[model samples]
Target: MKKIKVGIIFGGKSAEHEVSLQSAKNIVDAIDKDKYEVTLIGIDKQGSWHLNDQSSYLLNAENPKLIQLNKSNDNVAIIPGSENNQMIHASNGTGLDKLDVVFPIVHGTLGEDGSLQGMLRLANIPFVGPSVLSSAICMDKDIAKRLLQSAGIHVAKGLVYTSANKGTISYEKAAAKLGTPMFIKPANQGSSVGVSKVKTKKEFEQALALAFDYDNKVVVEESIIGREIECAVLGNENPKASLPGEILPQTEFYSYESKYIDEKGAELAIPADLPEDTTKQIQQVAIAAFETLQCEGLARVDFFLTEDGKIYVNEVNTLPGFTKISMYPKLWEISGLSYSDLISELLDLAMKRFEKNNRLKNTVWDD
Candidate 1:
């Protein structure tokens, strides 16, 4: 049996660039070699695409601290809507071997935000995760919340503001509406970049300025006092929710420092220490949220469980972290799926969705 050729795309022009590289590394290490042949496509923080050995420059060959695209390597462009979907070499104009599928390990902006998925759709290729619509919808916090709220799910009370509305909406008005100790974050960023806990009028103004650096639209939500819980959902048609996991952050909130920096900044409790009833309710709400978003492939649904037992759906990450220590894989691991097996399942689900989609009629005009 011939192994499928998988183009594992990593790195991107997003705040989560380094984290995406780490995810691509894990996928590279865990994907079954017996079943798949992988190629590395590295995109720089500036969004330049490169192929193969040339990508080594993006990271130190020995130890890499940041994701830097390999400048020495050749360049490849993915031209969708072509008979063959692939990255062609620029040197001799030779087309690289065709790709069976693309595993976009790109996080946040270009990767997770639906731009890459839209290209894949035009190319008529089967890439992993949700479709372009779902990806785009889930990428925007404002739209995601609206859709989830319409579905009757409990969400944090907040307001989405653009940079133009910064001064027009006074800090006093915002604080009055949402209260103090709120969280101000960029609408389109992930990994807690441009996210701040605004405890006072001064902090709110400063946080708004900082968030505007990353995105034009910012979200301000009242900070709910609760335990941070996360659940991983997988599959396309019949998605399954993994056992809940709790995050104990070492800070006042789960900021960037708690997520990546400070070695002892956070702790994870798999199959979270919750009462049976609470656990079941969280699981049920998680599935509801997943279905509400029309998500496929996988997602990590985060929540805030109040002391009185109220659960609030925070946000859904379509492309959650895949680092060996990430919550997505950890939850699956506790649910009886090994890390390697989880990777295989995701790939399988992608292919399954592709096959099912191919059966739908494409042409509508009658001759």
Candidate 2:
């Protein structure tokens, strides 16, 4: 049996670059060696793609023994178009490898926000995660909230502030509308990047400034006092939701440091203790949001479950973390999908979606 050539693409010009490296490393370590030939593509903070050997591709900061990128003939490039799907070394223009499918573990910004997806579409490669439209929409917090609300899902009431609104929008006015203790974050970032819990007028403005530093738009949502529960979703159509998990964060909220940098920052309670009815509602909502957003392959739906049992859709991560401690794979693991099995399923889904899409008429000439 021929092994599938899989391009494990990770690390990109994103605020979550290190997180991407960690997630990709975990995938590289967990992927079935007998069934797949893995080719590592590492994009640095400088936005250059490098071909990484297996050993270095698996190295991470947490690993006391770190293996840096092999730079001897490292620069890599991809030529768009189906016939030229090969990833080549820039120096000699040698075809380092061609990918049958790509597992994109790059989180945040250019990597997750449809830029990479668009490039993959142009390259005519089957890659895991949501489609370009879904990726773009989900990356923008304000847009995602609006779309989810339009789909009859409950999202926190919020206001979107852009650079144009800088002078006009006042912290007091925003606080009055959304109340104190609001959550401010970059509309286009992930992994809790640029996310802040604003408790006062002063903090609100400061957070908005910080958020604006990351993106032109920022989202400020009224605080929802509830347990942070998340559900892992899988498949392109007729997707399935795993048992819900709840976050027990040690910080003010799940900050960026808490999510990645710190090891004991948060604890995830898989199959979160909840009423059976409430669990069912969360599962249903997870699948509904996944389908409503037109998400393919996978997504992790986050929610706020109030003490009174009210549920509000927090957000949907198109490409959630896949590290050893990440919630996305952990939830599924508890729900009977091993980490390796989940990776296999995602790759299979990508191929299936690709084949179905190819069958569609690309031009009116086919008619």
Candidate 3:
């Protein structure tokens, strides 16, 4: 049997650029060599796509370990369409490496916001994670919450505002609408980038300005005080949930630093210490949230269990963090699936989905 050639795509023009690099490294390292031949495709913070070689593009602060793919000879172009269709134009101007699968280990914006998936779909390649629509929907915090709420899932109440609203919403007026100690976040960013814990009118303006740096639309939600829990959901259609994990942030909340930097920042309790009923409920809600956004492949659903024991779905990450320390992978690891095996499963799902998608007819001839 021939080993599948898998393109491990990472890094992008997003606030989570560094985080994406770490994820790509983890996937590249854990991907089973026996079943897959890996090729690295790195997109820089500036959004320039480059084939991996001796380029230090792969090396980053969070991911110091480096492994270079032997593709120093060419710039590859993905040809659009389904049916074993892809033309990797070589840089040496010779030959092509037909990718049997694309494992996009990128997070945020161009990576996880359905843009990359759209390109992959056009290129007609099997890639891990959600479809274009699901990715786009889940990438927006406001949209994801609305969908979850519509699905009968409990979600925190929040208000959406755009930078265009500028002078329209005074800090005092906005705070009156949504109580203080609210979480202000850019709708399109992930890994807690441009996310702020605003407690006062003065803090609200600063937070809004910061969030607008990352996205046009900002979401402000009343902070739910309680344990922060995360559960990883995998598979397509009937997905399974991994054991819940508790996030112990070193700061006010799970900020970017606590998420990626600061070694001793956050504590993750795998198979989080929770009541049996609570665990089951969280798992069910996690799956519901995944399906609510029409997510495929995988997602990590976050929730807040209030002091009163009320569970509120925070948000769902269509392309959640894949770093070794990230809850997505750790939860599965505790759920009897090794990191390598998790990678294998994701690729399997991608291929299976591609085959299923191939069955649909794209165009009809009408004379």
RMSDs, each prediction?
1.9, 1.9, 2.8
Top-TM-score structure, candidate number: 2
Give TM per candidate: 0.95, 0.96, 0.93
Summarize candidate 3's per-residue lDDT along 200-276 as a digit string, tens digits: 87798899899998899998888787899999999997899999999988778888888776657788888899999
What lDDT tens digits, residue by residue, belong to model 1 across residues 194-281? 9999888788889889999999999999889999999999988788899999999877778766665455678888989999989889
Which parts of model 2 have CA positions greater than 4 angstroms off? 58-60, 63-72
User: Tens-digit lDDT track for model 2 on 318-352?
Assistant: 99998777899999999999999999999999999
TM-score of 3: 0.93
Clashes of 1: 5
The true-versus-predicted C-alpha distance at residue 163 of model 1, in Å, is 1.9
Ordered list by TM-score, greatest first: 2, 1, 3
Candidate number that wins on lDDT, 2 or 3: 2
